[model samples]
Target: MLFALGFYTLQALHYYSPYFSIFAVIAYGLGISVSADFVCERLKSTRASFMGRNLLTAIGAVAAIVVMVFTIKDTPPTASNANLAGLAQYMRTSTDVPGDFYDYAKKPSYSVMCSWADACKLQYLSQRAMVSSANQEIGIKGIIASERFYQATSEDEALAMLRSLDVKYVVAGGRLTVWHGDISKIGISGANPDKTVRVLKGDELPANKVGQLMAARMVWSSARLASSGVTSPLHHFRLLYISYYDSEKPPLLLYEIVKGARVVVKAKPNSPVAISTNISFNTRRFTAWHDSGTTNEHGVFSTIVPSSSSLVFQLNR
Candidate 1:
């Protein structure tokens, strides 16, 4: 009765879809119900009916599977590098893709992506909740096929999938970062020592690799001025590098922030260097935060924010 349940759910929400989710739910429910009928028939000495029920269940299961597979496979490609900047901004405020997307922050509850009848139970949860997925496969498995998650045979395919899904953020290692050139690693981990590119979501891809290299080179030049990882205990002078996929200009000199405990920085005498803070945070909902600005010639800035989890930026004196 999954179909009926979904229909009732949609009705409760005042949804107007043709009840596709309801139908699927019903089909699957029928499969199970028919199997139960078969068992009951066997108990009542109804041999012919048991066979028919078994066949019905089998058919229903196959139909459900086929419909779900087709629906997932036929989803349209969603990426367009052409207004990439604007789309990235929009996605920054969004938590998940359109199909699996949900928001219970309002009344008259509504269905988001995938199922179109009722709000997902997940919508009621707060954004601070975190779901850890150790690997791509696990993460993909957690999401419906129509969602942003997918299994690709190759890195190119995976990148293509991200583009198709208009994925705004990606978490990967240095090797994949170098390969895709679109995504960057964020924060620091013992597993990721180089601390190359961390968060790659920005307005536009640099015009060319030279621009990217320039950005990397600039970061390397100013590494001594960047901030340390949010988790770092013993702070020291750190150089930061943020990488990206579309190579057009330098990846970006996000800003040089200080790292060591109780450390302070001011631009050296006669140095006209400018700097700004790059703020970021992580919870279950939003992936990363990036806001870049410049500092006065003296290059002085500080904040008393929490050191344990807060990502900070301070330029070296």
Candidate 2:
């Protein structure tokens, strides 16, 4: 099992392989027992000597156990790890029922797109389905779809991908800023069509990792893509909840795929209609986003815009 992935590559993962580690522990244990036995053979066959030998053997066993325990890394390795409890609770009680989803699924459920699909604690706690996960569990197509969705640079393209995947929710944040080292940034050669590496500009992350980084950056930028030079809060996706998380390990942010309210505007024939709106949800971190569309021959233009429950409720006013 150890040789299957090659001796050098097994160290790539932070989590140790149980099979390999167990074998290693057993081999070391046998060696320790043999050493203890050999040393005991040289001792006198008296009661005191027997007692001393037994004591030495017990000490060796305890030392071996201590070494194994001390070498083991803690799961997730940090207290600052993102908390999925709040997001899980919301997914369980609140999300859209089974009706807004596909026909095959009859039970009340929703699919979520997560950053680390392999760590399925969120799904297990919430009892929800995932759009895709690591290791091609949902198939290679699902992984491809997920990668395309994450790497998308445009909101329109991202929305289309989400809609196609039938993902109603998104799980972003939690090590989204991870630098995948040299292996991740190795882009396929544009000229050769072969697996070739390209020289990327300084601090330029790979295409696959850009969206994850952007998601984390967006949260810090007050739910807006300021770094992208955009003033819009993600129009189609609304932030439903931000789980309890640490500074270094950001919280898992839950977003609902929303169909913004359709608003029609009237203008002169062949005139351009400038559209803009102000929005805020978690806090009064208000931001305005703008868009423009040309009016049709009827001097009318229709567009979808984000609306909040607070806007309709009198208490928030």
lDDT at 163, model 2: 71
Error of 1 at 181 (Å): 17
- List RMSD in Å for every model shown: 17.0, 11.0
Model 2, 1-317: lDDT tens digits are 53323222322222235356545554555555666666666665566457645776676566556545643532322222336655665666767654532344474344677755423565555556676544322323423454445444567877777776677887775343111221222244211243333334653466554544334334544354542335434666666666654645455677777776666777786787766666553324445555566788978776555554312211100
Candidates in order have lDDT scores of: 0.32, 0.52
Candidate 1, superposed: residue stretches over 4 Å from native: 1-19, 43-226, 229-268, 271-278, 284-317
| Residues 93-171 of candidate 1: C-alpha lDDT, one tens digit per residue | 4334333323334321111111101112212221111112111111233343222211122224444444444332332
TM-score of each: 0.25, 0.48
Output the worst ten-in-a-row residue range by lDDT, candidate 2: 308-317
Model 2 TM-score (2 dp)? 0.48
User: Considering every candidate listed, which one attains the maximal TM-score?
Assistant: 2
